[model samples]
Target: MANYRLVSFKTCPWVQRAAIVLREKKIPFEFQHIEPDNRPDWFRAISPHNKVPVLRIDDRISLFESASIAEYLDETHAPRLHPEDPVERAINRAWIEYMPTFVDLTSGHAYVDSEAEFEKAVAAVPGAFAKLETAIEARKGGPFFNGARYSLVDAAYAPFLQRHLFLERIRKIGQIDRFPRVKAWAVALSERPSTHSFPPAEFEAMYRASVKKRNKWISQFVTEKAAAE
Candidate 1:
């Protein structure tokens, strides 16, 4: 058995995708909490890009973009997360690539900019949701992305699916109900023991608090600028 450690942050979709793969594979590993802004020096040493979701497999350190990580884990682990068939695996990989584009269009990279930017992002949701609706319907036989069993594609996407559901609660984006297949898939994925195992409430609370603080700072900045004028 290889000694394993995963350096990650809760709110990062990339990190969450990797975590989902690890869980599905039933791989035993240590989770090291690293905040995005305050990443530890050791993490920087291991990952030249200073990204979260860096995995240490004994002495070999691996830094992967989420899709690559899922594929690598699926290939290495006991309970496989990918199909053995070449054509099926290609289809799975295609969906995995498709997810990031949907996530980008729907969630708008987590509204990381001005309110004007956020509004523009929110406006893009409907079209993005439409694409997802089509994709989900295409895979309607699925409890997982590839049909019966969960695959690397599902693991790669689970985090974004969760965020899309959560965003519906916080923002008036497109309704998940409009995408019935996706809605069911997200609910089922969320209920998985591994999916539920992470500390969502705690992370959400922290994120909400951070948003409030940032909003307050912006407000104060505006007031100060007006006063100066």
Candidate 2:
């Protein structure tokens, strides 16, 4: 195995995806955590994009971007995470690439400034889930996106799905309840050893604390609602 070092920020969804793929592949890697606000000169020197999820394969080759890191990991390691057939593999890759939309849709609900906004965001959430419901419904018997065989699509979405834990408690949204298949899928992915890897226990606590100061509107809204309930 080539020397591997992954630059990540705990709880960064994009970085979590890369970390999940590394763990799932059973590839030993050095996990280097860096704060985005205070990146060192050496890190910025290597990363033109200045983002987490930069995987250092060696001194000569450093890769940034989650998808590229994942694809590289899948290609280089054994027990391939992507599908074998060309079309099916492409389909899986399409969903893997589509993960950002999942983050966007969930954010609309998770970080609202007011009750009206929360309601509006919550109302819109089903529409998002409805689309995923269609896709997941098509593939029955799945505790995973790819059924028995866990794939890169699962890794891509696991971070997004893991947010359900925080959203359910903080937002009081019955999002997972609305979509049975997706709910089951999230639970399965989260339970997988690799899904729980990377970010430590305090990561979520730290996230909530940071966001509270960052967005007081959301902090007030969620706090009031949480108190009422």
Lowest lDDT block of 10, candidate 1: 220-229
Maximum-TM-score candidate: 2
Question: Please, what are the lDDT tens digits per residue for candidate 2 over residues 72-136?
Answer: 98998987999899998998888766678767777675566677877787776777778778887
Residue 215 C-alpha lDDT in model 1: 59
Residue 166 in candidate 1, Cα distance off native in Å: 1.5
For every model shown, the clashing-pair count is 0, 0
Model 2 scores a C-alpha lDDT of: 0.77
Candidate 2 off by > 4 Å: 198-200, 221-229
Q: What Cα-based lDDT does every candidate model obtain?
A: 0.68, 0.77
Per-residue lDDT for 58-172 in model 1, tens only? 8586665666667777778878777788887787777777877887886663555566776666677777767766776776646766667887777767777776665554443
All candidates' TM-scores? 0.82, 0.90
